[model samples]
Target: MSVADAVAPPRIRCLAVDDEPLALGMVCAFIEQTPFLELVGQHDSAVAALQAVHAQPAIELLFLDIKMPGLSGLELARVLQNGPRVIFTTAFNHYALEGYKVDALDYLLKPFGYEEFLRAALKARAYFALLAGGAAPAPVPPAAPEEDHIYLKVEYQLVRVTLADIVYVEGLKDYVKVHLASAARPLLVLTSLRRLGEKLPSRHFLRIHRSYIVGLGHVQAVARGTVQLRGQTLPVSEGYREAFDQFFNRWK
Candidate 1:
């Protein structure tokens, strides 16, 4: 393998186990996109994956699915001795936290987006590197002020906007539109308001409505349930108004 291939995060010599052929293809495609990963082989059955891993000790990673015909992914993982690092791919959210018992690097939910997959891959890379004499990755730095930001890749452009700059965010089904300061148009993203909410400073951003988050710093006006910011009127919903009130009162 070339130097580039040797060092790419995905090139860790992978074996993917999934009963669904389409799922297997999608995982393989993702692995192909990364320079560091290589598909040593794939298996539709957990038993087959187990046999291959035992036969081929050099396979360093397993992207095994949790729900499979015959032996379950967890059962297969348990039977193997001196097995490769595992990254469980599953649809069940309940199984996510439980995967750590078998020493899984990460647990990926089914129908995962590229970004979500990348996040899990990040965990796997750090775990492998640390095992190979690399120091443990540093704890995430505390988010302060403008530290909470998102990179919007749109139309071949990357726009960096802090959570503080947002006047409000409106969710449109699977997408969200962020109204920020000094932007002519809202920063549209293929994400949820809930996801963006996690990246924001809780003290500053309030989910006054199911689809809206008004930045505390940008609250231009408030009268009853109505919130006015940047000449835009937002609502403090019945369910969330108390949350806003508690936060707003504490800030005062």
Candidate 2:
């Protein structure tokens, strides 16, 4: 075998789906140009893509478009809860929130350039690499002051969120829903709970469960195996129970 073949990185099998022929073609082209991505199939409908996914269980990634005729991209993602990761490509920016809700790896706006596409592809590569037990890349340095506030990618914009306003954070696979005191709906961002936990000030936020992090100041009551905030009760997993108890004792 050639040295190049032996040294080549493992390619992530990918499937592209878009109702528009041009859009579908562009996505497939991008996948082909990416060295770490292998284009396995291209389909113009979500149903066909679903079929492909079932037939080809080796597919690790999906470039999905949000708005399709019979089965929308969002619907497909929800149905494939344990399936391959998704990277949404769509013209409508409004679907960004929905995409995150379904735990998409990244969202590429319509008319995106190759640079944007490559950035999204790299994210997928890193994600799969981590899953394969590869060394993780260093976290990006926070742009804003880590103490006072931090910036979160909300939809297409980076919104500065004050540290104190956060009541809690709920982890959903590849996304986190930041529950704020000033907002009715939680702001969903594309990040893992462990990574976000590192960004938050440990003094104010304590992880109660693998899927939850609570702001100490917002917690009203601490009961056995649970904590209450804003009329909502959250579990305190066995792993974090000891640390939680220590924090609870400090206030008593």
Candidate 3:
């Protein structure tokens, strides 16, 4: 390798794939923060990721989630050969050994901080760096445990809705209506918005009003103390305005 080649930072073409929208958003955000990692695409499913991988041959790194509805990350890893090096991003701790069995570069537990994520990313960078330098790949470290999802009780049954699926929740006196993706109507549950908001991940959901709590991922537009969702606009109460503004400023 020449002097320029040794110093030149190789852009790691990356792709993020997770069934949870909020989770995928976080991974993409982390990738964008890394100077050497170039985000090529993001997908909500392993099937979609497979399609993207086939379409883009240059993608060299994958941040993949496990336990999706269909075509889990492990299955996708099995199907692809000579494909991008994968770093399994999952909520479950039990899958760590399974991930390494497939020769994954790393395992990223859910709700990982930037420091943890950056550590894994750098390992991938080092792996590629070694390959570029004509050396054997380095060993990847085991992942630490992190919180990931929440369960909600709706109607007469328990509903397991990932924090990512919740768009916005509306409180009507004693009941809170959860507006989630793929649901034709909101899931009305007997709970206060404040109570439900407390259960959700604070980084992803914000209580803008006494009656409404909006998921930051689903927020499309914000103007004049109001936030726009898919079809509804919710006001930001004076009590929460400052916090909402802070989140908006950082998000934008």
Candidate 4:
């Protein structure tokens, strides 16, 4: 199925909450610039976000941090009077169980790049569309199933890019940095961090942080605090720790 066919809905309302001001700002900024998304408000603390939720009932999506100084994001979610759809953000992987318990729309690791963010957003959009009855059933595979790929808009041209050729993606303000084996420099695409991820294969990609995605094969080594791939060093977010272990253990 084509990417547009996979994502038929037009728009979604979103909010972001994180203890770190930079992280919160980043999420809010991204939401504001996205075509299919609206930035309802931003919170540096879960407590504050809760208050906003009460005042503004239009918040349909939440980009939350699992860890916060005063009240943890997960705890805040538990006490919300009328909660919006949650997309939990964290620096550690240990909270995956708790996050899933709440059926959070998506879980994001800290320092996640835009493409990774887009992937989570797409999943959230899909869920909301189904819940709202605004989406149609998945198109049946053609008589002969074909390999999946994505069409990316580069400047004025829509380029066909193979999913497997992707090594990693980075989020630049108002743009996405896409890395490919053939290109010397990563290509920048104008798209939401979460939106680009919708076109990628879930099994092959994982958001270890808010700003980076390490291809399973391209990953050369991973040690405490950092991962080495294609001669670049990538930091690991604390929230993804549990998920990282799970990922490494499966392959080893």
Q: Which candidate gets the maximum lDDT versus the true structure?
A: 2
Count of residue pairs whose backbone atoms collide, per candidate? 5, 0, 0, 24
Instruction: Using TM-score, give the best candidate's number.
Output: 3
| RMSD for each of the candidates | 17.1, 19.4, 6.4, 16.6
lDDT: worst 10-residue window of model 3: 134-143
| Model 1, backbone clash pairs (residues 3+ apart or across chains), number | 5
How many steric overlaps does candidate 2 have? 0
Higher-ranked by TM-score: 1 or 2? 2
Each prediction's TM-score versus the true structure: 0.51, 0.53, 0.59, 0.51
List, residue by residue over 13-90, the lDDT tens digit for candidate 1.
888888876567667767667555778898999989888987998898888898887899988877753678888887
Candidate 4 lDDT score at position 192: 71
Q: Candidate 4's error at 233, in angstroms?
A: 18
Tell me which of candidates 2 and 4 scores higher on lDDT. Answer: 2
How far in Å is the alpha carbon of 164 misplaced in model 4? 24
Q: Give the per-residue lDDT digits (tens) of candidate 3, residues 50-159.
A: 99999998999999998888899999988875789999998666899989889999897665567788889889988898888854335556557444556778778898
How much lDDT does each candidate structure score?
0.74, 0.85, 0.83, 0.73
Ranking by TM-score, best first?
3, 2, 4, 1
Q: Better model by TM-score, 2 or 4?
A: 2
In model 1, the worst 10-residue window by lDDT is: 139-148
Model 4 misplaced stretches (Cα beyond 4 Å): 1-10, 136-252
